[model samples]
Target: MQNRQQSEIVRDILTVCNGSGTTITNVMFHAYISHAQARGYLGELIDKGLIENDIFDSRQYRSTPKGLKYLAGLETMSELLAIETRRIAKSGANIC
Candidate 1:
């Protein structure tokens, strides 16, 4: 799979939880990606076992263990980013 932007990857993680069920199309809409790109990205995520597509209900997808791990990592990264931003602000870096 090609390297995707962090926002796209993060959005893919969240897309599975949408109440309407998880399809590549739904994920694309959630992630604000074009339909074609969503299909390719969803295929890569499935192949990596980070996501599992429901065999009984093709439109549904769920996070796998690997996907949960990835989400945790992303959360940690987000926390770190927030901390750094706060530190810079406190230092009067004028980021705003």
Candidate 2:
């Protein structure tokens, strides 16, 4: 797994792409992440063979099988955390 920031950026991009094909500009703007950071994240994902670029549309990117696996893992973790939070709430445990 990558560092938190990189993982988060990749996850955000994947989510955006899964919903609707996104341009680099939209990813940077909507995700509230820096342009450099977004570009860096994309580059890393591409290098890792986790994403592929659409040459017909230079800005278009799509997640590969590896990327999907990573996203699924992240989603699983998120769901687990949500479930744990609910359990804690039900137990009257103060999270803060």
Candidate 3:
């Protein structure tokens, strides 16, 4: 399996919780990260105001509007990079 970047993992987590709140376990599973990683990321995201713990259920987390914006930006960057990669391939240019 190819390793994903931290930003990609963050995006995955945000996507998972964007519509409805989800537990940390769901975030870990969906982001393909370990428990420790999930905890760390969740803490950081919460601190950054990108995610918030549900008031009714602290175990559940949901993405904030800022997080959605961040996710959108990351998705756009990924798409642009993929397009550049395809263009380079067509031109027979090495990316690395």
Model 1 misplaced stretches (Cα beyond 4 Å): 1-4, 7-11, 14-21, 83-96
> Of models 1 and 2, which has the larger lDDT?
2
lDDT of 3 by residue, 31-68 (tens): 88899999999999999999999999999999999999
As a TM-score, model 3 comes out at: 0.82
* Residue 66 lDDT (model 2): 83
Ranking by lDDT: 3, 2, 1
In candidate 2, which residue ranges exceed 4 Å CA deviation?
1-5, 83-96
lDDT of 2 by residue, 1-96 (tens): 223445556677776655335687877865567888789877987898877787688678777778888899977876666533333455787542
Worst 10 residues of 3 by lDDT: 81-90
Best model number under lDDT: 3
lDDT of 3: 0.85
Q: In candidate 1, what are the lDDT values of residues 51-94, reduced to their tens digit?
A: 77776897777777787787677666756666333224557764
lDDT value, residue 67 of candidate 3: 94
Instruction: Tell me, by TM-score, which candidate is best.
Output: 3
Q: Against the true structure, what is each candidate's TM-score?
A: 0.65, 0.70, 0.82
Better of 1 and 3 by lDDT: 3
